[model samples]
Each structure stands twice: as structure tokens, then as C-alpha cells.
Target chain A: MTTLLPRAGARPPGRGPRTAARRRERLTALGMVSPAVLLLLVFFVIPVVLAFALAFTSARLISPTPAHFVGLRNFTLLFQDPVFFRSLLNTAVFAAVVVPVQAGLALALALLVNTKVGGTNFFRTVYFVPVVTSMVVISIVWMFLYQKTGLVNHLIDTFSLGHLHGPDWLNDPSTALPAIIFMSVWQGVGFHMVIWLSGLQTIPADLHEAAAIDGADRWARFRHVTWPGLRATRTFVLITITIDALRLFTQVNVMTQGGPLDSTTTVVYQAVHTGYDQQQTAYASAISLVFFVLVLAVSLVQRFLTREKD
Target chain B: MATTPTPAPGPRRRTLRRIPGHLLRSALALLFVFPVVFMLISSFKPDQQIFADLGSIKAFLPVGQLSLDNYTAVFDRVPAGRFLLNSIVISAVTVVLGIVVNSLAAFALSRMRWPGRRLLLVLIIATLIVPFETFALPLVWWVNKLPWLELNGFHLALTEGWLDTYRVQILPFVANAFSVFLFHQYFQSIPKELDEAARMDGASWFGIYRRIVMPLSGPAVATVAILTFLPMWNSYLWPLMVVQDENLRPVMVGIQYFFQLNVSWGQIMAYSTMITVPVLALFLAFQRSFINSIASSGVKG
Candidate 1:
């Protein structure tokens, strides 16, 4: 927090060594920052602007002619497109199901491990192993387990009490997206659990002791103290999980490839499919633009709702 | 009314009560580890045996016809070594460049007195909200037209495009805003007096950065390296779009080649296991700092 800025009114009557030194410092600062700034400008800023511009044109990846502007045709077509609607719905459903489940399980796991227990690090590492592993690797491994005669089914059959049977988890349109959701929550919960654990650690032990002395039971103590203490962490985890859920591409791409009837085609997946596989750059940009706005709006709303009140 | 004398709960009873929770936690941890263990164990088993053992707990254990057949099949079916090498090169280059580029940018903003520093920082951070998928297609078009310099045998040649090259994968990711932000936050905590002291001794800004800032910022560097390395190693969609040459494809893209008709489950497991080992090893080695970094930054992996 130290002020590195030179004094505002330190001007001498004439140009001097101090002024020259100040200018040199500025030049050096710009020199150091220019490489990253240049990269971001070229890669991120330009592409983002180009994505918006491309969304208005009938652009194709392999077309020879320059793309002609098509006005709002791409957006209009997307609005009426059944597959796009399905993808949007699927993404919404995925997020709605995943954010709560992952965050809740993470919080529960955090609470469980936050206790003064032996081998806590062991459990933490074990839970977090999947989080570190690549999503593609996890998806491929889980795809094996989700097969008809796979480990999950085998487990179901072994413990079935004579009434249960394992279904084709990935092939069934009804169950495919949910199956992906299950694996995602399994893989991702540990990350948020760590976040929650850190948040829990920041809560002072004396607050719990004070609540206990005031006749608060475990549930009551959590309700009055822990939950309130973790409000900011909860907001953060919610936004991050929401963002992750909305950008659901890797699992679907690896496991189902948008599935048996586009049941698992998320917006991000649909955008990629359209852009790369179908080679409809403009349409894909339109879809991506809509998705981007949706995410931005959701994030802004979440921030507004969670903003601290003085 | 006189209360009846109740036996005080012994330490053994309290300990016994905690056992169920501990047991429950262990079971859940096993649930998390089960797939990874299954991937590793099944990698050693034949395809038929993998399916055969599926009906029992034996599927998870290293028993019944374990060998290197699946691993060999993985190598035969795909260029596993080539893919691994590509990924290693790509991730290493990205990490090295990312640390340098991002830390320098962060250093300038965090340490140096400059105009509009706060504005620049905010602008850079705002880019995080824009997901890569949104700009990915446009970036493909952009990079395809971008020029590059390549060595053709003994002659150095200027190339027109960056597509189908290692630099494409490495360069776009070099200037990650999150890494910059993390470095910036870390730099802010470093006292400015150190910079002033170094400055008084005629140390240039770059000298101060290399000699003083970076040496003291080991934790930040590790955090950024891990953060940068994970995404680069796990990158699939971008490479799939930009990289066309089989030799240039990273490990994740090499995965799709196994998903053809008559999918080789054992081979897939083998490939997955091979790819996952490096990640697990890295995490295990730096588990504390990795978790601490994520916790402090509130960034998901």
C-alpha cells in the first residue's frame, strides 16, 4: 500500500536530473509491461472484438471470398434453432444441477475435514487428486466406468439387492447429461472443498466456543456462526462453479460428443462444434456472443446480489 | 427432585463415537480415488479381463492377468511417446514464458510508478470474465494469418502462419491475466524499500526485477508455473482447432484417436494412466503450495 507515486507538485522551474530520472522510470515501466500488453492486445482484445464483428457476417473458415455482413440473421437463426435451444437448455440444466451439488458436497467435505483429525492431509490429497488430473483423462477414465458392462454397472449389480439393474449411462439421452454432471461434481468438489476449508479456518475458534457456552448445539452453531462467516466464500464458490458449469465442454467432448440426440450439447460445446466441425465461423461467433453475454449478465447479477452492505 | 447418578462418558466412548465419522470419510475418499485406481489397475489388465473383473471388486484390484499388453497396445495404436513429448515441450515452454511475461507485467504494475496502473490492472482482470470459447474461433482465424519465422533445414525462413506449430499452443497462453494478477498481488506485499535500496545502488529496473523481485518471489513463481502448466497440459479444444499435424498434437488430442469404432477400453485406460501420472506426481510433490496458491487466489484448477 505504499505510495510509489512521486509528489504531484514537485516541479522545479526548469528541466532537471530529477525530471529526467522520473521520465526514465516511466519508460522502463512501459518497457517491462509492453510485451504482455502487446500479447493481450493481439490475442485477447483483438479476437474478442473480432468475434463480435464476425458474429454479424456470414463467415466461413475455408471460404475464399471475404465474408459479407448478414445483419442479425445469425442471431435470428439461432433463436429459432431447435438444437441451439436444446444446447442452451442442457447447459442451464447442467449448471442448475451441478453448482448446488458440487458446492454443497464441497462444503460438507470441508466441514468433515476441518475437524482436528489424524490423516487429514491424506484425505485432502485423496479427494483432490481428480481435481489436478486433466479433464480429458478423467472423462476418458469415467467413460470406461460408465459403459454398459463397466465398473459402475458392475458395482450396481453387485450391490443390487435383486431389484436394480445398470443402464447404459452415456448412451441414454435421458441419463447422459446427468451422468456427466455426476462425474463433474465428483472431480470438482474437492477444489471448492479446499476453498471452503480455508474459509472455515479463518473463522475464529472462540466464536464457536462462545456459541457453545450460550447453549448452541452443533447445528445451531453452524447456522448462526459458520454460515454467516462463510458468506463471501460461498459467493465466490458459487460464481466460480457457475462459470465452470457454463463452460462445460471438455467432458462432453470426450465422453458423449453431445450425445444421442444432442441431450448433452452445452452452449460452449455447440459453439465449438459449429465453429470447428461445421466450419460456420459466423454462426459459432453468434452463439458464443450470446453465451458470453449470458455469462457476463449472470456474473454481474451474482455480484450485485452478493455485494457487501455497509 | 434428586437426579439419578449417571455414569460419566469415558474417553473410549467418545473415541468410539468418532470412529463412524472417520470410517465414513475414508469410504468417501475411496470413492474419489476409485476411478483413478481403476484406471491404473485396469491399464495392466487385458480388455477381456477388464470386462470380466467388472462384475466383482476385482476390477479395482491389480489381479487376474496383469501385464503390459494394454500399454503396448496404447503405444501401437497412437504415438504415445510423441504426444507426451509434444505436451511436455508445449507445457514447459508455456510455463517458462508465462512466468517471465506475466511476472514482468505484474512487476511493472505493482512496483514501478506509472500512470494509469490501476486502470490497466482492472482492465486486465476484466478479461477473466471472457471465456476462451468466446474468442477461440476468431483467434484461430487470427493466428492462421499471423507470420512466423521457421528454420528450413539450414536456412532460416519467415513463415506466414502460426498454425500447426508449437508456438501457437505456447504463445496464446503466455500472457494469462490470472497469472499476472497473482504475481501483482504477491508483488504488492514486497516492501518498496527493497526496490529503492536496489535503485540507489544503480540497479536498473530489469536488474531489480531479476536480482531482487524474482528471487524473493519463489512462491509466486511456483504458483504461476503450476497454474499455467495445468491448463497447457490439459489443453484440448484449442489444439484440436489449430493443430492439424499428428506429430504436433498434444496428449489430450491424441485421446480422440482411441475413440474409433471397436473402442479399446484397456488401451484408453492405459493412455489415460500414462497421461495422468505426471500430473499426479506434480501435485503430490507440490501439494501444499498448490493448494495454498489456489486457496489464496480463490482460483479453481
Candidate 2:
């Protein structure tokens, strides 16, 4: 919106002066924003540049120096390494499953509350509590709840069903990542619900009333009135969640430590493990570089789709 | 045309209007509150009780199991007091410094007619899309180099550690890209006439910002503080990397021992409860404002 601003004297409202003022305005903007621009260069852009450089060298943690140029070696190693491949596969599966499930749940919750069905404010507060609580604390709480003889299994036993025994959630190789994903969904669903609720509000009440007047059912009103208004909100939520899902690390670190045979070791986790634990800074940098590109790609694709819809 | 006001809703109509919707809404609210209710209940129960009797609704009945032992035991095993202080100090300092720096930069970007503003604004927004981990290591190295930039001549040490210093932990996080973006967005939203009128009265750039822009942007500042504080307090990875000394760790990091140590469930429950209550209370106080900011941002397009 600041783009609407004129340079100092554009208030005179003439032709040549306005053009010259625009040029000067551009320069003045550069000077004004230089501090932030410089900070980003030093901290964000520069680090990314160094990460790329480090990917080509053997810069181990202790060594501090680029020991030697080993072009494509780290990248090649990542391809051949089974752990790297598995981490990638695990991340993809996690994102693919969790994003849609969480979004869908949020939509359902938002609809229920938006219609003034019951205690909307109370329900909103309850759903959003997890988002406020620290992830570390939540992870620990869920860890206890997911233990071998934990509450989940005890509940299963009450059903008199032998097949539904809950395993040690964080300890089992197969279930560890999935368990973390479930916790993430629980924590994350609220934020999306808030966004969807806002979208639901923008949907004019008259549309719903009109649809009902025309003998439309609940689903039809939602389809024709509610969903159309949600397009922008949906796009924003999708991009934000995708970025968050792709960058999943905290839960795995706190609960599983990417364990039970490394089933939960995401790209970010592996990068941290490589740099800190294994002391392979260059390789870790390479992995991080890949993760960065992946995030950028997903963000760009979402942005493109959003722009197209607009 | 003579129109008589309608009588207040009849008893039968009122009853008919309220019953079904009230029941469904209450039921839905219960589902949302269930997990939190479950959490509070489990916190009071013994570890063995949680595991053994999870199936029974009676397991959560807050009759005899409610105990203060866990809360007291938590205080015994950890420096709970110091952790709380650390969280308060860090979050308070970050919020204050973050507002000052971001507002200054945002004002400059919004009000100043300078070059490269568009490019700089784009850079700020772009940084938000990327994860903070990308900058973590390199920023650490940058902070370590700060001491060398002092009056003393530079020396080539392979590694100059700034580990465990509040400066190291806090300085790197001071210049928040999101806050700058948020402030800029808000400042732009304020009508230029308010700024122009102040300037017309001979208010300088700084004068205009202080008198006109600052007072009008109260909601924005509150939004910035709430958004920034929660994340700063809950943050773990950056704190873990920077603070080698266990004593300097924040509450979130300190709470990790509840899992790692072979502590009793009472202790664990107490620590977790302590850590969560302040946050839960904060959220309750600002729930409407919090949701309002998020909703506004999301739907603005």
C-alpha cells in the first residue's frame, strides 16, 4: 500500500515533477530500508551463499576450515546413503498424509463452530490450547501417553479387542514417525481452523439464507456459498502448513530423537545430526541446501497457484 | 403506516429456538475441551495409575488422586525458579528490543522515500518463507566475531566462542523479519493524512513517528508483543545450541529433564503443569485479540 505514496513534493500534482519524484522516491526507499536489507544479507542471504560453498568442500565441525574441494561428493554420498533416502521418503509421507488430514479436520471444526451450533467461544479456546503450549512439553506429555502400558493401550484393552493394542509409540520403528505426525496434527489443526473461520465469516449470510430459501441442503449451501469464499483463505493455510510440515523437526527431536531405527529422521534432523553429532559440516550443509530448495519450490508452486486463482 | 413493535419472544418460541442448537453446541465444545481435561486429570494421577486404569472414566475422576506432591517434587529436582526468571527476562528483553528495532526500520521503509525499498521489502518477506535453521550456524559465527570488532585488533582464532552469553542468544534473534513486515504492513495501513497533518504542524520525521504513528499503532504493538513472546519462550533448538551451561537454559529446555531423568511422575507432572499454566492463562486473556490478528492477516489477501 505504501506504493501509493508520492515523493516529498508530489503533492504539487504535476507531470514532469512527479516522474522525477518517483525516481528519487526509489532511491530514498533504498536508503531507508538499507539496515534491514544489510541484516538479511549478512544473516540470511549470506548464510545461504556460504551453505552452497560449504556443500562443495569437506568442512567438518572441528576443522573449521574447508579441508579440500570435493565437488558433488557430498551430494553423491547423500544419494547412495540409505538413511538419507529413508529420511526423504519419511518426510514426503509425513507431509502428504498430515497436511490434508489436518486441513480437513480444521475445516470441519470451523464449520461446526461458525454455524453457532454450540458454545463456539469455549470450543475455540479448547481447540487452540495446544497451539499455545510449548511443543517440548506436549511431546513429553504425549510420550507418556504413548508408552507400552500407556493410557492408549489401556483404553484399547477396555474395548475387548485384541487387535487394537497400542505399542510403545516413540519406541517402535514403524509407528514412531506416525505417532509424531498425529501429535503435530492435534497441535496444528487449531491454527487452520481460525483461518477457515475467518473465511466463513466473509461469506455473506445472505448467500446461505438464499440457498436455504431455494431448497438447498446444508452441503449444497456450503458448496455454493462457503467454499467459494474460502479460496484465498485455503491458499494461505495450504502454503503456511506446507512450509511448516516440510520443516518438521521439533517433535522428533523432543520425543523420538529420530530413533527406533531412524524412522523419524527428517531432512532437517539429519542435517543437524550430521553437523553436530557426526561432525560432517559439509555434508550437512549439502542436505540443508536440498531442504531449502525443496521448501522454496513448494512455496513457489503454492504462490503460483494462488496467483492463478486470483 | 402505523407499525406496532413486536412483543418479546413468546415462551414456547424461545424454548423451541434454543434447545437443539444449545445441546449440539455444548456437545461440540466438550469434544474440544476433552483433551485438555484429560491432560489436567492425568497430571494428578500416579504414573502407575495412568497406565493401568486408562480405560475407566473413573481414572480421570479428580477425587483422591489430586496431589500437590508432583508440584513440590518438580521444584526439588530442577531450578524451576531460575528457569521462570530466565524465560521472563529473555522474552521481555526480546519483545522490547524487537519492537524498537523493527519499528524504526519499518517506519523508515514506510515513510522515507528511499531507493531499493521494494527490493529490501521483498528480501524481508522472502526470509520469512525460509526456515531459521538455514541461518543458525552462520549467525552464531557472526556473533562470535563481534568481540573481535571491538577496540582490540583482530586476531585469527580458528573459533572464538560466544557460547552461553545472553548477547549471543539474544542479539542474533533481535532483528526479526516478520515483525518488520508486520509493522510495515500496519504503518502503511494508517492514513498518510495523519502523518501529513503532523508534518504540517512542523513535526520532524522522528516527531511525526512518535506523536502520530506510534499512538495510532497501539494494536499493532500488542500484536507484535504477543506473537513474539510465546515463540521466544517456547523456543528450544536455538537456546540449546547457544547455551552450553545448563543453568542458563530457559524453562522449555529445563523441562526436558522431566523426560530424560528417571524422575517420579509427580515431579514430571508438576513441571509440565507449571510450564503450561502461564502460557494457557496468557492465551485465555488474549484469546480474542490473538484470533482476531490471525484472522485479519489470513483473510486480507
Candidate whose lDDT is highest: 1
For model 1, residues B209-294, the per-residue Cα lDDT tens digits are 99999999999999888888888898998999999898999998988766653557888888888999978988999899877876
Candidate 1 lDDT for residue B54: 81
Where is model 1 chain B poorest over a 10-residue stretch in terms of lDDT? B1-10
lDDT (tens digit, per residue) of candidate 2 on B113-207: 66656777777776776687765554444444445333345655454566776666565667788888889989999999886787668666677
> Which ranges in model 1 have alpha carbons more than 4 Å from their true place?
A1-15, B1-9, B150-158, B261-263, B299-301
RMSD of each: 4.7, 6.1
lDDT of 1 by residue, A1-310 (tens): 4454554555543446567888999999899899999999999999999899999999987788989999999999999999999999999999999998999999999999878867778888889988888998888888888888777887787787646777899999989988999999999999999999888988999999999999999999999999999988988998999989999999998888898899999899999999889989999999989989988987888888888866
lDDT of model 2, residue A27:
58
